[model samples]
Structures are given as C-alpha cells and as structure tokens.
Target: MAVTQVKVDATEARLAAIPAPDKGAAWIEAARDAARARLREMGLPGRRDEYWKFTRPDSLTAPEAPAAALFEMGEPQVFDGFDRVKLVFVDGVFDADSSDDPALAGVEIERLATAAQTDIHWARETYGILEARGQTPVPRPLAALNTACAGDGVLIRATARAEKPISLIYRHESKTSDAYLHHVIRVESGAELTLLENGPAAARFNKVMEVDIADGGRFNHVRAQGRDHERRAATHIFARLGAEAVFKSFTMTVNGQMTRNECVVEMAGDDAVAHVAGAAMGDGDFHDDDTVFVTHDAERCESRQVFKKVLRGGAVGVFQGKILVKAGAQKTDGYQISQSLLLDGDSQFLAKPELEIYADDVVCSHGSTTGAIDADTLYYLRSRGLPKAEATDLLVLSFLAEAVEEIEDDALRNEVTARLGAWLARRRG
Candidate 1:
C-alpha cells in the first residue's frame, strides 16, 4: 500500500500557537518540553488517520471552542447519597472555595498546579509518563498535547484503603471556554481507591489521566460525562498494572455534540486483571466514540472491553477496540464486545474489533454487532400495555445493563442506573 503523506504546514502552525506551559517545577517543565516535542513530530490527527477516520477532528482541533450554551442541569447528581471528598473545578480551574481540603487519612491529594509550585512530589514522576509510554504502535497526539498544555488537575496517591470515594465534579459556566486538564493517580501496593467524576467542564475540553498501580493494588473509576448538546471533548486514560493489580473503569455519556474517549491499558505483571466498559446514548446530531486498546505482556493476565451505545435521530456512534497478547504471555485471557442499538433508520453505528495474539496458549475473543431494537421483544413489552416510547426505553436499559453491571459498587451502580433512567425520561417527554 502506498503511504499518503499529509501536509504539515497547518498542523505545525496550530502546534506553535498553543501556549507553552506555565513556569513550574523543573521536572514538570522538562516533562512538558518532552511531550511538546513528541506532539510536534506526530501532529494532530486528521480525517485521513486510520484511527480517527470514523470521527472528524475539526471540532476538537479548532482554535476556539465551538459555541455551546451552558446546559441547565435538572436531574439529581450521580452519587448524591454517598459521603465523599469532593474536588470541584469550574471552567477547568480548580475552585478551592467550593472544594474540600486536599487532605485524607489514607490518601494524599494535591492540586497539580499547586504541587508544581512547591517541592517535588511523586506525581512529578507519574505525570504524563504512561502517556509517553503509550506512544508506541500508535501515536496519541491529543494526549500528548494535553500533557504539554494542561493547566490544572489533581494528583492522588493512596497509601491505604480509602475511607470514602473521591469525587471530581466539573461545572461549565462559560460559552467559549477551552479547558485542558491532566490527572495522575497512584495506588500503592495493597492499597485501594475509588475515583468518581461527573461534569461538563467547558465548551471544548482536552483531558488526560495517567494511573499507575503497584503490586496488589486496586483502582476503580466511574464517570458520567455531562449532558451538553454542543460541547466537544477528547479524553484519554493510560494505565499500567503491576503484579496481581486490579483496574476497573466505567463511563456513561449522554447528549454531547462530540466526545471521543480513549483508554489504553498495559498489563505488565502476571495475574493482573483489567476491565473497561462504557454505555452511551445519543440523540439528534450527537456523536460519541469509544476507542480502547489493551496489551497483555505478562502470563495469566485477564482483560475485557465492553461497550454499548444507543442512538436515535441521525446520531452517530463508533467503537474501535483491540486486545494484543505478546509472545510468551501464555495463558492470557481477553474478551471484547461492542454493540449498538439504532432507534431510527437514520442513526448509524460503526465498530471495529481486533485481536492480535502471538502466544499459543492464550484465550482471546472479540465481536461487534449493530442493529435496531428486537421486534419481538418490543412487541412483548407493548403487549404488556406499556407505551411505545416507554417500551423502547425499557429495552434500551436492558441492552445497557450488561455494561452497567460491570460497576462493582452497588450504590454507585444504582446511581448510574438512575441517571440513565432520567435521561430516557427527558427524551421521552
């Protein structure tokens, strides 16, 4: 195949226009410099890039934020009943007046911007390191851009089991705010922490989160990307797991004009387990994409990718997931499934599932399916005297239950379910 070379003049100009990172600690400045160099070489992804072919990058790469009206939040917040340490950001800047103190018994938390102004910390080593490591095989220039320019986020280290979950809540009050944020999390050996995020941060957002799990550590992440009809965002999560570590992440997205979520996992130690799942719903000019990559480099590691999207009224959904098992990583177990339910004929779903294994004793499977609601099942629900809209919503919830079930915490799962239900109710009304 002949390779097509893209013109770099425009891309180079955009990279040059991005403001340099604010002066910080020496190590942070060094890291940003390295990331900026890498991003310049790789350039921003365009329509021709194989990985970004399904979704256009125009909205995401624009110099100014696409016009997005601030959405009035109506439904009860996710995890309303839970007692947790809250860190709040308004327009992508840390709001200390609205947020709790960054002090927890078992976990040490600091604002990345504040920490960079003080002495060196552990986050200096972790910030953007995994994103740098994930640059091979495929380049993630958006993540690299975030690493180079992000102005605010949090750094968390867990030394013991956390007494309560930590919540990062974002509020979008500006119509043209462009926000870039990066978060680094480290779960030490035998430590556990649950991280929760809920927000519509800005009109345009770029985010990167890097997590490092030591031996026997466990990390749970659950997020609900907020409902804003004109918002656009590109977010990436890079994680590396040590021996016997556990990593689980789940996300629910509703009503964004464009959202692209990329999750990359490297199982670098034996007996480690990782699972990532998402359930998204879109209606009328909405576009949502979930791209995930998992690599197994150690023996007896397990990984799974599950995603489901419901689209209606010309909405577009895309899923691209792959699992790779390296040579000599015997007994690797991998599973992946991406499915979509199109409520109307005009809606569309695109999926690409791949599995590449070099080990002989590995068990790997992947599948993708796109279809409308089951006619028979719809009929059964309608026969029970449910309205057509209610019946359809019921079926949608049933289709998403599999992905939602991956959330291990019962209360959090219920909260997510309620949020989904509320979204459906609003749509039906």
Candidate 2:
C-alpha cells in the first residue's frame, strides 16, 4: 500500500511554480488556480487508497507542456437517431459547424463558456463545481492536471419534463497531440433528459464530467469512449442526486491503448435511485478499466451496478466497485456485480468488489468473477459441429449481451455491438 513519494513530491513542486490567474477569464483562471493550489495538498494514490488500489496511477506521468485551448476542429460524423440536439468539440475546443439542436420549445442547451459570462444562476451553480467536492490523495495526477487546464464544455438545462433526448459529441482529431476536457451537466427538477458523449483518438485525452440532478429529476447518460491504438484516455463521471431523483448511466469502452472509466454516484437526498451498467472489450495491447463507487447517504435510496469485460491477446482489464451506506441511511439497497472473460493465456483481469456499511438497517452485496471461456459449454457447441473460433465468438456475444441490453436505445446498442465485433476480429487475426 505504499506510495511513490518521489513522484508525488515532484508533481507538487511543479504545480507550485504556475503563476496566478489573470483578471480576464476570471472563472476559468480561478478554476486553474484552484487546481494548482490543490495539487500540493493531494498526492498520487497509494496501495492503501482503497478506491484506486486496483487501477494504478503511478504509470501516468504528466506530459511536459500545459494543455492548449486552441486547436483545429474537424468535421464530425453525426448520429442518425440523435435528432434532439448535438454539440461537438474537436481537440478540446467547441466546433460550431458540427453542433445542432432542434429549435424545440421548452428546452435550453448552451455552451459552458458563454453561460459563464451571461447566465449568473447557471454559472454559479455548475461552473467549476466539481472541485468543490474536493479530492482524495490518489497518486494519479490526471484528476488534478485536468482541473488545472480544461476547456469549456457543453451545458444542457432541460426544463421540467423534457420531451426529447440531448446528445453531445467531442472529437479529438489531433492524432499526434494531447488534450484535456471538462464538462458540467445540470438537470432541473421534474425534468427528463438523455445524453450521449463520444470521443475520438488522440495521443492523450483526459476528461472529467460532473452532473447534478435536482429533486424529482431524471437523467440518463450514455457514454462511448473509443480512441486509436496508440492513444491514452481516462474519464471520471460524478453524479449527485437529490430527493426522488433518478440517474441511469450506460458506458461502452472499446479500442484504446490504455483507458479507464471511473464513475461515482452519490444519493445525497432521500428516496433517490441510481442504475448503472457498463461494458468494455479489449484486444491487442489495449487496457480497459471500469470502476464504480456508489454511496448511499440518505434514507430509502436504491442502486444497482453491473459491469462486463472481454479481453483478448495481451490485453488487460480491471474493475473495482464499492458501495457505502452512511450511519443514518436506513432502508438503503445497493447491489454490484463484475464479470470478465479472458480469451487467451496472455489476457488478464483484476476485479475487486467491496461494501462499507455504517447503518444497521441496510442491504448491500457485491460479487466478482474472472475466468476463461467455459470449456464445457464450448465443447457442447463444438460437438454440434460449430467451429472453435465461431463458437467462442458466439459465447462472447452471449456473455456481453446483458450489459448491451441495458442500452435502452436499440440503434445505439447495435452500433456498439458492431464495434465490439470489430475489436474481437482484430484480436482473433
């Protein structure tokens, strides 16, 4: 559980040299300054950092140059069923040419930078709000580095009971460069909103997303992160729920040199509910990590988490999930499950499921399983005259079907399934 103090000390010293924020762009400057100040206070996570024990952060060393704000944006491929609205970011900058929102009634979707300048209420409530939650002493510098330099993100505020879904896409065309992005989402009370966020390949791209839901609101988020073979990416999503608020999240990860998706959901208000499902497919030298931390801080909250991973070649997969119930969180119900399939001897998987309970009246359970293809089942299928490879592929699809089914949008689910097939084929070859 010991940490590398040398790296932590070096990172803190580097952050201390950054100059203060300029008077102009005060909010962004403030955010960056806050990040630097917090850097000295935070260190890389150690083995003792229970939340990050599985996914080691010491491997990620900060790049030399600071993240840039100006970069060329390329034409983005639009989704067919996403007629509600679209906002695109390329190389961490908002691209106007690729954004579209149906001029519908009773809805408002805008950019975070513009909102910061004009809308006081919106800016005050959500702008750079993720930092207020504070940071733990995780050895990973991406979180702090992301806070230090992040571009504006798309903001959506659907009024009470939204009628349509909202979609946002961020593309990284900088095949040889690195980028960082930050996004904040706020859903008002009694409203219903669906969102899709996509990312392209880059040498490196780190993203942090914070979503806040008011009482009686419903937010359904679907995230897809697919980058090039040599690219590295990490995403952190934190959601805070209010009384009677409902949050459903579905994540699909495929094709990355090294990618990790970390989700933290807090039921801070009574009667809140959260449902989360995620799927990751890794091939070649790719590494995909999906971790979840759900906390029940109020009474009568319910949550369910399901994660599935498929690995091939020398690929590696990791899943760490935990559910915690506070002292007064009576009647809390939380469940978590993680499953993985290693197709070859070179493939590997690490899974950890933990539960921390302080309240006497709560229900929580977690389970994890990591194993190779079931030989008995495979033999049965091969005995029926199916080829070995074909039988394995079929079994893989069947194993991953549960997580894919969680995607309520069938079209999107099919698209992700196609991507999964492509990744598997490459590994087989």
Candidate 3:
C-alpha cells in the first residue's frame, strides 16, 4: 500500500522527536527493523481514515507531546489492597526501587530490556508478530511505530496457573514525557494468568500489548486509566486464542484530555472464547475512544464486546467495534453493544458498530445507542427522598453496572465500582 504524503510527514516528524534505542538481540533487532519498514509503508493515521473520522488523531500523532500538569491525587490508588507483584514505571522508565521483586511472582518474569539482550528468548517468537497480523484490513500505524521504537516493557510466560495477579503501575512525572511501551504475554496450555494495569502513564503515552494463548490456556486482564485531566494517550492490544482457550479483558477510564484504546482478537481454535468490555467517564474537555475488532476463524467460537461511556459538560466519547466470522467458522456466536449516557445536552457520543459473516450457521448481532439520562428513572429516584444529584449518581452507577460486571474477580469489581462512585460523588460535591 502506498503511504499518503500527510501521513508520511506525520510519521517522519514523530520519529524525529524520538531517539533510537539500543538494538538488543539479533531477533529483537530484526523485529524492530521489520516494524520500521511496516511503519514507512502504513504511515500515520489521519482523520480521513474510515476508523478515525469521528476522532482526531492530531495529538496522538504529533511530533511532540503537549505539556500536562501533574494531578494532585486526593484518594489512594485503586487496587491498593490487592496482593500482587507490582511493577512501577515513572515517565516510561522502569523503577526498581519502588517495585516488588519479580522473583516473588510464580510466572517467569523478565524485563523486555533484559530479555532482548539474550541471543534467544521465548519472546522472540511472538514480539510484534500479532501486532503485524492486526495491521491488515486496518492500518494501526501508531502500534507499528511502538513496536519499532519502544525502549522498555515486560515479557511474561505463564507455564502454570499464577496464584496472584501481575500489576503494572504507570506514573506520569514529567510535563512532556513521551513514552512507548510494548509487552508480550504467553500462556502455555492449561495455564492461567491475570494482569492488572492502572495509572496515567505520561503526558503522551503509546502502548501495545500482544498476547498468545495456547490451547486450553486462559488469560484475564483488567485496566484503569485516569485521574490525569490533561494527558493524551493511544493504546492497543492484539491477542490470538487457541483451541478452548479463554481471554477476558475489561477497562475503566476517566478524566483524560484525550485517549484512544483499541483491542484486536483472533480466535483460531474451536470453542475458543473471548470477551472485551470497558466503561469510560469523561467531563469537561475530556474525550475517550474505544475501538475493538474480533475475528472468529474456527468452529463454535464465542466472542462478546460491550462498551459504555458517560459524558458531561461538553465531553466527547467514541466507540468503534466490529465482529467478523470467517468461512467454515460455523456455529460462531458473536455479540457486540456500544452505548453512551450523556449527562447533559452539551456532551456528545459517536459510535460505529459492525458485523461481517461468511459462515452460514453463525449468529451475530451488534447495536449502538446514545442518549441522556432516563427521565422516568431519575424522577422515581428523586421522589424517593434522594437529592437530585444523588439520584442521578445512582442511575449513572446502575447504567455502568454491566460493563463493571465483566470483571470476574469480586474484589476488583468492587474496587472499580467504589472508585467510580467516589469520583461521581466528589464531582457532585
């Protein structure tokens, strides 16, 4: 494919601002070279792109990160009480002094920088491999750029069920930090792994996470991005699922200047299951976007995508989701829904939901909606002696319940609910 002149210039300008990192092992260097070549061919995403029409990519593709003021956190971080191996990153650099020992985690945990130094490693087979696959049918130039230039991240392989979750904590310390991170996770057959992520990574953050789940393997993930009002970010997740494998991921977002989150999944084995869900709340000048694509290539596969957003005070939200069932992918069951709750008329929500099927026996459905808070429900709550604001907050939580329910862990679910509830309450106060 020929790259557009505007995109070429945009891509070039971004690279010019970023310094090249140490090329690690032979395989790592080869992967980075391939990614750079891919970026040149694809260029950067423009508003003209079909998928980017509703949301501008200017800040995400800019040559330099916009300055962001630090947030004065008033509450303890989410998931603070959970027991897990915590890895900390400040301005995209790993912080060993604040992080827990990786040895304490059951899975094989190695920093990407460390693993890339070795001549051979388990990550060599999968790094940037899935992201490359995800590019076709849709060009994700930012992800390709990340693969080519990311300086550090983590590589994890789970050979057995991990007793506790692995948490990645990102802290934005600099006003102009531009950070790129790439992560690879492999779940061996019959093994299980859970990942938890939170925090505002940087003034401008770009991240890519690639996951490969073997037959009968299971991978669970939950993420929270928020509390930084002026930050801008773009993130992507590419996953491949094997026979009977299970993959579930959910995210909660709030209070960012602008953010775009994308997830791409391919189910290649029979009876594989994949679910992706998220909830985003934005106020004032905030904007959040969720883009997801899931493909069913094997028989009897099941996939679901559910996303909801709450917007107020002229905030904007966008959702783009698609489900594709290939030929011979009979009995494929896919469902998708994207909806938005507007707290006031000034807020806006844009959605595009799609389903493509080449199989005769597959069942697929998708729907999208945008609307203000329910008047009848609000009136009922207010009549019950609750203040108008309190009643409205209750309905907002109720509206977000489904997406929050996607989190399988009771504690995690409760924490998300409480955190969001607190945000709503504080805003009302």
Which of the numbered candidates is closest to the native, going by highest TM-score?
Answer: 3
Best of the two (1, 3) by lDDT: 3
- Each candidate's number of clashing pairs is 0, 5, 0
Off by over 4 Å in 1: 1-7
Question: Each candidate's TM vs. the true structure?
Answer: 0.97, 0.86, 0.98
User: What is the C-alpha lDDT profile of model 1 across 1-429, one tens digit per residue?
Assistant: 222245255456556666765689888888888998888778778788899989998888766667888877765677767889999989888999999887788899988888877656898778879999998788888999899998789999999999899999888977646888899999999999999998889998899999999999999999999587888999999999999999999999998999999999999999999999999999989999999999999999999999999999999999999998999889999999999999989999999998999999999999899988899999999999999899999999999999999999999999999899989998878
lDDT of each: 0.90, 0.71, 0.91
Indicate the worst ten consecutive residues by lDDT in candidate 2: 65-74
> Which ten contiguous residues of candidate 3 have the minimum total lDDT?
67-76
Candidate 3 residue lDDT tens string, 155-267: 99999999999999998777747888899999999999999999888989999999999999999999999888888989999999999999999999988988999999999
Alpha-carbon runs more than 4 Å astray in model 2: 1-5, 12-28, 44-52, 64-81, 101-104, 119-121, 134-141, 383-385, 425-429
Candidate 2 deviates by what RMSD?
Answer: 4.0
lDDT of 2 by residue, 1-429 (tens): 332687577576545433322232566566666765565455544345566556555434443432323233233332444566777787766788887743435567666556555524464565545544524322334566666766566666767666666666766565436556667777888888888777663456777777889999988888777634556777777789999999989887776777777777889999999988888877887788887778899999999888888888888888878798989999999999889888889988888788989999988888888888899999999999989997898789878888878777777778667756765665568
Give the C-alpha miss distance for residue 229 in model 3, angstroms. 0.9
Q: After superposition, how far is residue 337 of candidate 1 from its true place, in Å?
A: 0.3
